[model samples]
Target: MSLRCALQLGIPDVINSHGKPMTLSELVAALPVHPTKTHHLYRLMRLLVHLGFFAMQKVADNHFQEGYLLTPASLLLLQDNPSISRPFVDLVLDPILIETNNCMSTWFQNDDPNPFVTVFGEPIWEHASHEASVNHLINRTKASDSSLIGRAVLVKCKGVFQGLNSLVDVAGGTGNMAKAIVDAFPDLKCTVLDLPHVVADLQGSKNLNFLGGDMFKAVPPADAILLKWTLHDWPDEECAKILKNCKEAITRNGKQQGGKVIIIDMVMGNQTWDSDDDKITEAQLLFDMEMMVCGIGKERNEKEWAKLFFDAGFSNYKINPVLGPRALIEVYP
Candidate 1:
């Protein structure tokens, strides 16, 4: 939550705008905190710095010997960043979700489908579908994540879209991923399929459009199907169903050469990081628990993913560990 506090206070933005290390007093003056709370800012900064969100740096300013500077991880917290993850942070740290998480023990002792169902009286999807506010938060969270992860995929795996003539981003919230893809591949027609409420008011352009549908029932036919962070939101059976729909979508035209399903989601125990292995592992673990508590899904390893693909009637698959802590998997039919 300290990270959320920093984002709330616009600390990263302040430090980044300074262009140089910002002294403690400068940060105090720039922030909106009251005079009495100025002293507490130091404690917050200390914790944030220790957590690697910021670094203590020697500044030339005479007001203080050291100042705070934004770290690489903190850059994503900047409000103006195109790939800002603040929305995800806000969604997870929201008070309602926090309260739901607190009911984890109660959920364990009961027959709830998940902790969210335990507290909210229904699954997250039901509540989000009925509650406009919750639905907006979920969409915003997915959009924020897609912007960040999509940038990496475009950079590292642009080839994944090269041969495809048409693509469907199943559950592509708000079309952020589709927007990026369409911009990168203008000739490649792109469609964003999401819940009706999620895409109801969204607009599209020449190469991009939106469709409201359920992945469990059917996915729009396309040369390639994109499932970025979609399947991990469901259990094995549901994932199998989604993949089956995707298989049918890709093979609908009977053009077998370039039809494939491109997935961008976390693959458990698949990191080959030269450093920060522990940090990546911790993030994957935390996200796995988040899935378990928030939904019925769990992160899958290569073996599990392969089993799901084969069971769904896919011929073969490939995993590219290009996205840190996540992977870009190509499953072919």
Candidate 2:
């Protein structure tokens, strides 16, 4: 909550603007909080500093003796940062998610397939289908996440897109990933396939276009199909169907010599960071639960993923673990 409070207060950007460690008095004066509540700000900052969002430095001066500075984590949360994670926090902490979570215990006691269904008598998607405000927040959060991941993927995994002329971003929200790809490879044609509501009226560029369709029915033909953070929302049978359609799209299209399907999603047991912190592992587990609660899927281990690919009739595949909390998987026909 303190992290959320700091973000709500724009404390990181304020500290950044100061260009130096800011004393409590200076920080309070720079904030919009009530003058009578400056001590509350100090307490909040104390917790934030302890949580590593900000660093406290001991400084010697006549007027002030110590100050706070932004940490790397807080730097990424700054509103003006291109890779800001602010929207992610908002979505994760939104009342919709929290309310859904509150139903988990009752859902486990009942016959409901998922917590969301237990709470709202419908799938999360169906709920979003009617709530434009919630849908918009979902889009903002997804676009924000894609903006950060797209830039990193282009730099660290350019080879994934090498030699590809036509690509499709399956269930791609707002076409951020496809746009990034087309911007880097102007010759490559990129299409984003999603529900009608997702792609409706969305503009496209010279090498990029939008297609509204259900992946369970069909996917647009392309040399390569990209599914970033998409498959986790479904179970094995549905994922298999999507992969099968992807195969038919990439191979029958006659775009390349056995085209590939590139997937970016979490593989449950693949995390092996040397860093001893348990937070990442915990977050992954939480995400697995999120999939379970919001829809009909959970994170898979390597063997589970392999089984899904083989079940879809893919001859070969590769996993690249460069992305945080998720990996890039290339499935070949």
Candidate 3:
């Protein structure tokens, strides 16, 4: 709730744009609230500081007065940051999702598929389909996240797309990932495959095309198929089916130079470095719990991921732990 309050109040953006550690008076002045509420603002800042959203430093003489500064987590909330996670933070903490937590108790008593249905009177996707506002929020959140991931992938994981002539981003939300790839490799033809509604209003570029279709039925033929955080939204069997389609899509490229599927998703227990071990693993587990509550999915460890690949008829696979908890998996037939 405090985090939500902070975001609503634009505290992170305020402190970030301040260009220096923001004093309490400066923050209060910048806030839209009444001047009489300055003390209340300080209380809120104190709590947020304790929660690690902001850091407090002694400023005035004698270390009596203090100034507040944005932390790494708060920095991601800055409105101007290219990779701002504010939309994701807002979406996950939205009132619709928050209300579902109360239904968890009753949800376990009944035989409902998930708690989301119990609260929203429909499944997550069904509800999103009916609610235009929620659907827009979800799409925006996904696009923002993709932009952040795309920047990192283009810079650090360029090797994944080196020799590939054609690539398809299956279930690609708004073509942010495809745009990034196309920008980096203009010669590589890129296609974004998603639902009709998702691609309806989205624009395409010279090298990137948007295709409206279901992955369950077909994916466009390409030298490589990219599935970024898509498989985790499904059960193991469903994921296997999607992987099979990806395999078929790659095979369509030809038998002599059969292609591969590039997956960017969480692979639990694959964290090798200390940073990955602590931060990435913890975030993945948290996301797993979130998926369990909100959708019919869970984060998979490497062995589990590999099992799905093999079950989908892939002959060889390699996992590169480059994207935090997520890995760049290459599956070849």
Candidate 1 lDDT (Cα, 0 to 1): 0.90
| lDDT of residue 11 for candidate 1 | 90
Report, for every candidate in turn, its global Cα lDDT versus the true structure.
0.90, 0.87, 0.86
Give me the candidate number with maximum TM-score. 1
After superposing candidate 2, which stretches have Cα over 4 Å from the reference?
59-64
Model 1 over residues 185-301: C-alpha lDDT tens digits? 889999999889889999999999999999899998999999998888899999999999999998895647669999999898897665677778888999999998999999988
Whole-model lDDT, model 2:
0.87
Residue pairs with backbone atoms closer than 3 Å in model 3 (clashes)? none
Report the C-alpha displacement of residue 201, candidate 1, in angstroms: 0.3
TM-score quality measure for candidate 3: 0.93
List the pairs of residues colliding in candidate 1: none
For lDDT, candidate 2 versus 3, the one ahead is 2
- lDDT tens readout by residue for model 3, 63-123: 7777899898888788888777888988888888888866778988988877897787788
Candidate 2 residue-wise lDDT, 9-111, digit = tens: 8889999999887888898889999978888887898888888999988655644478998888898898888778899899878888899989899999999
- Candidate 1: list runs displaced more than 4 Å: 61-64, 273-275
TM-score against native, each model: 0.97, 0.95, 0.93
What TM-score quantifies how close candidate 2 is to the native fold?
Answer: 0.95
Per-model C-alpha RMSD: 1.4, 1.7, 2.0
- Better-scoring candidate (TM-score), 1 or 2: 1
